[model samples]
Target: MTSLLFVDDETKLLRILSSYFTKKGFVVHTASTGEEARSKLRDADARIIFLDLRLSDATGIELLQEFVPRYPNKLFVIMTAYSDVESAVTAMKAGAFDYVSKPAKMDELEIIIRRACEWLDMKQENRTLKEKISKMMQDQEMIGVSPAMKRVFRMVERAAETDATVLLEGESGTGKSRIARMIHRWSDRKNQPFVSVNCAALPEQLLESELFGYEKGAFTGAHAKRKGKFEAARNGTIFLDEIGEISLPLQAKLLQVVQEKSFMPLGSNQTVHVDVRIIAATNRDLKTMVEEGLFREDLYYRLNIIDIFIPPLRERKEDIPPLIEQFLDKQRAKYNKPFTLPPELIDRLVEYPWPGNVRELENAVERAVVLCRDEQLSIEDFPREIRHAKPDRPPSDIALDPTKSLPEQLESIEKKLILDALEQTGGQIAAAARLLSISRQRLMYKMNKYSIR
Candidate 1:
């Protein structure tokens, strides 16, 4: 049975309420003074408290302020005379769940209790949902200890502290979109909506309408008015992924929004203003595109205000072990099984160049965990691409000596690889640079350092 405490200075009224509620199948408790009510509250287990607005020793608001913060799970309903309705409203504002006028009707009190119980149940469900979301985010948090990732983390922290436009530039599968969300989650607008739109996912017309809402009859199939991402993300964030794919015309429109914080909807003269933080991501080099006259120089400059470049997994191989562990932990929790990896497996994975970056590594780990019935993950359990993958340079090509220090051995391998690339390209610097996947300037620097003729 639900428990309730009725606090009133009138002994007769308290007795009447207590008897009525007890007969109605409630576990009822009563107190005739403010001091006695406080004592009863501390000892009695009650979900609802009926507090008289004007107690003999203390006002209901005073006791309410003391109790609500202390016992946030409990409900307090104010009992006041009809003439004291104004004070009862003040009590409600002060944290009383509801108010009941003196000469309280049995039906009315029952209705209030029903509503309060429903509210408490809804609150509990919301709390549980929030807990689940928090756990998921904690499990999928960014895992990196490499210097490259540390620099990214510091930039993310600084970006989260402000509402600047952030442009995340990195190769595909490097978690640029995830970093965008991290910025939003840690920003001041964390409680607000975080809207994401893939500019490449839709065509120009559709993408424009999706971004800025259309009025009725504005477009061919415009049956009714629709709110766009900007309106939906009011006072929050909008992540535009694959931003470089946007058409030049749409780029101009987007540039206006970025510059003025306002945009006109498709076929609509009226402009809709929005207060939103824009975070854009792309795998392409916007600066190169700007110089090539493909992308607008102005828009590129605007979005590059807080540019963050996320390095690919191959460049940060030291972070691979921790990333693998994080992915394994998530899979283990999901499958409710222990999965072990051979130490040699880790070494091979670290040596392999992850072309698809973190996403590929995570997918490989998940696949291994799901297929390994013996609880020991092996390279064979992973995709063929990962298992058969070879290091960038073969040890046979370097003829590495075991006596040399690790650094010297690595330098020998690098120099040998450069020499081979130069020979294959007929000593053409540009072609060799392309074959090595290094800039011409970088390859030239290495040639000078190694004194290659």
Candidate 2:
């Protein structure tokens, strides 16, 4: 249900609007002061707010300025008096969803509310997409056709079918977090919220409170009771990225949630039961941490139920060309610019040892797109490290023809390289992976991904 907030000093007006909305099947909340409205906005989890132009505490535009940024999830609708209509324009400039005259009829107000909710949702979705494919960060879009990637696919497929606790193990930039999202999308809980939190981003106590939420007066600044990520992700999935970074104490708390499916908010004995699937990803080896007495053994076992390991990019050089092509396509579409990669650049990129894996590859691509203006990108357009790095393999013949797309040309070269490595190594996976400077697991996956076997 969409919660609507109306903040006005007029008690009679608030009472009338509240009654009307409540009768119209909307959850209506009215606040007579700015402070009260803030509390109600948090408590009601309001998506849309309507504030009068003049409040006893502050101007409506001032409140809009404060609320819009703080609650990116919520939209504010400014209600300005007809005489001082200029303030409404100011409110819109301050990121207000829409402005309305003081004497808006019930039907007109209803129309405005509908449009406001839709606009807010659209903006939020676009922001999410940009964040996902920004290249510098994590998001879905796994590009690989190596045997190493095929094994990953098989594991992800198995994990997605069940509501089992999944632990994605890999180094940073190998796309562990993205694999978690893929499992969620494939699961029955796809329609529900998929909340993700970086366990390493927050300190121990704060991280605990964030995961479990807190009751009112639970601690300082606990002005109102707040629901945590677990609660918000009820009937969905909660991805705990960098799970191994959490403290031992928090690990025990997390263990309880996994076992009992219930947890207590900070400073409260009352336990809240949650029906959320936990998807954890970590770059750290929890077994070593457990042996070192840093991570809890019980928690480790619980999360390791269905482990999916992602190999580093260097271990799967065969995947680079497709990844490069994917990035190029994304950048071209994003900037609405035509981009072409020269043959030497593709050979250089594939030969360079990508220490940062796919994440580094994306950053390099984004950098080139930003600085490049020529018809085709060359070695000069890439980073100094990439441009100067020594190749582990011979240069690929990716540019003998300019007609093929990046992926097509890349695939042709990758196939030839794999064929040469296999023939040179007498069909040994380990030796082939080493000669290619990729992991054995990745080599096997790539064999399956490319039908190299």
What digit string (tens of lDDT, one per residue) describes model 2 on residues 1-453?
778999999999999999999898889999999989888977887788998878888888888888988998887888777786567667767887666677778886887777666767867755644443343224435766677876786687678899999999998999887788888876899899999999989998789888999999998989999888899999999999999898877888899999999999998999899999999999998999999999898999999899999999988888898788888888888988888897778877878888888899999999998888675787788899987888686675445668888887778788788889999866755457668976545667778878887
| TM-score between candidate 1 and the true structure | 0.58
**What residue runs in model 2 are displaced by over 4 Å at the alpha carbon?**
1-140, 393-453
Q: Note the Cα lDDT for every prediction shown.
A: 0.87, 0.83
Q: On residues 1-453, what C-alpha lDDT tens digit does candidate 1 reach at each position?
A: 789999888989878878888898999999878899889889999889999988778999999999999999899999888788678767867888777778899877887787677768867765654563454359475766677876787688789999999999999999898899888987899999999999999989999999998999997899999999999999999999999999999999999999999998877899889999999999998989999988999999999999999999999999899889888888888888888799999998999898899999999899888777688899899889888888666455446588999999888889999999999876866457768976555788999999997
Instruction: In angstroms, give how far residue 220 of model 2 lies from its true place.
Output: 1.0
- Candidate that would win on TM-score: 1
Per-model TM against the reference: 0.58, 0.57
Against the true structure, candidate 2 has what lDDT? Answer: 0.83
True-structure RMSD, every candidate: 25.2, 23.9
